[model samples]
Target: MPSGAVRMSRKRAPEPASQLGDVPERKRVSWGILISQGSWADRSPLHEAASQGRLLALRTLLAQVTPVTKGCHANIATIDHVTPLHEACLSGHVACVRALISAGANVNAATFDGITPLYNCCSSGSVGCLELLLQNGAHTRARHAHLPSALHEACKRGNSQCVESLLAHGADPDLKVPQLGSPLYVSCLHRHADCSKILLHTGANVNVGRGNDSPLHAAVRQDSRDQVTLLLDYGANVNSRDEDGRRPLELAPPGGPSQQLLVSFQGSPRTLCQLCRLRIRNVIGRSRLKHLPRLPLPPLLTQYLEHM
Candidate 1:
């Protein structure tokens, strides 16, 4: 009608009834349109943006979605039951994860493979993302039998900061998975001395571990003097036997330093100071152990109790 306006003519608007077959997903996502969660793996543009750490695109897509679907897109699961939050967390995209979470994504959404966003964040060692999920009420512990514990994932990955965050948030330090054993055991098994030390400091039972195997046994097998010393300091049971009826000393390589340390520990006693430290920590309670410095005790005594 207008001189500057160009009219586009469609020769055919409609064909036969239901004769065009199924439309390609891209057909629905034509130019200038932003759509998400199609019929295939159920992945949306949001999932793509979140997974690739495209923060700008992710925000833009969220902006284009309708009000009802804006927050929902952050939560829609793929065929694998993986949300965009999962993708962003797994990829360690803090800003994207924050965006998804701010858009009302469920912080505790678990995948078909028993992974929560917290678990993925810990696995990726992104403390920022981990903090975001935790602040959003992500379960510090797995709520379902199918969901793996985020603390265990952190320990297995040797992420002490993540482990500490989970612990500080009330995660069970001694949670024992049937296949993975205790967090302490997995940390020792993986040679994560720092993680094990943190677990020990947080009052994890030194002698408890995966069925019949002690953290000491894991440390002995690893032949790590640091692990052995740390466990010994925490009063790990040297005489503890595994399923194979073997002691930690037996697991160490013959004539190795760990074996020699175990030999000395077998016949000797822990110092009065070490015993007192352990007793004080136990009496202080795990929940209150973090406040040891504020108890008006001597700073040196407090540091000793906290293993500082």
Candidate 2:
């Protein structure tokens, strides 16, 4: 045997709950070891096998564990207030999630901080977990501490599948939180083209800028021609001013490829946001009305403004 290592001839089970060190009282538990040992759900042989990805073991556990435990929503050590189902959903273990849900696990159970199983999957971009949660009646519009809706996560990460899934299930694309704005705004700020497109198609306010400005301003700042065009085509105002008296056109970086100045219809800086909305809505409305081809700016709008 090596000087520092001891080799055991027999396999050993993990430390029992009682023999294990003290379980701290906080929030957010790690199901890693419990899932690793396969008995995290109550020392059931089926749980052990399921933890190991044993399909038959999972089926058997789904049929057996609940009957024995009477569908108890027990905590896994690492997760503060989350049950085994939360861990499964957070880890994207679809089968395990299904088993837990089938076993009467509360799909909407939240951790102490308001994190939910759906939030975990959404933040991680796990479509499988998302679908599982949705199918099991998960709250599609649920919010959590420090996190917006799952749609916000999907938009921020540019996860098309999750966005589509959430929208199809009636998740409000226009939903807003203090930290993250509308899904369209988040997508625009992050330059997530597909996600932004999806949000626009789903009736998100393309012209409604987030925070101090609109999506047009965000696209201009990033000099994202594609995103800018998409926003414009979908009804974002090109002339909308923010709190700083800067129009989306004025905020365009040193390089961009579109220049169109539609003065605020109301011609009032006090209502600049509304003016920008109107101009953008009119442009987009006309385009839609006439079925015009997508317009591509001939040169960066910033450079054009310099000449004017």
Which candidate wins on TM-score? 1
- Evaluate residue 280 in candidate 2 and report its C-alpha lDDT on the 0 to 100 scale: 54
Stretch of 10 with least lDDT, candidate 1: 4-13
Off by over 4 Å in 2: 1-68, 73-79, 143-147, 258-308
lDDT by candidate, in order shown: 0.80, 0.61
Candidate 1 regions exceeding 4 Å error are 1-41
Quick one: how many clashes does candidate 2 have?
A: 13
Please count the clashing residue pairs in each candidate, in the order shown. 1, 13
Q: Write the per-residue lDDT of candidate 2 for residues 1-308, one digit (tens) a residue.
A: 22533111111246556744453211113332332232323334433443344556666655654556756633232324545565565456787777777777777877654667776676557789789889888988665435446778778768888898888887877788766667787888888989987777655777765676788787777777778777755546555778798987677654446333223321533345434544554555421522222344454532221111
TM-score of 2: 0.63
Estimate TM-scores for all models. 0.84, 0.63
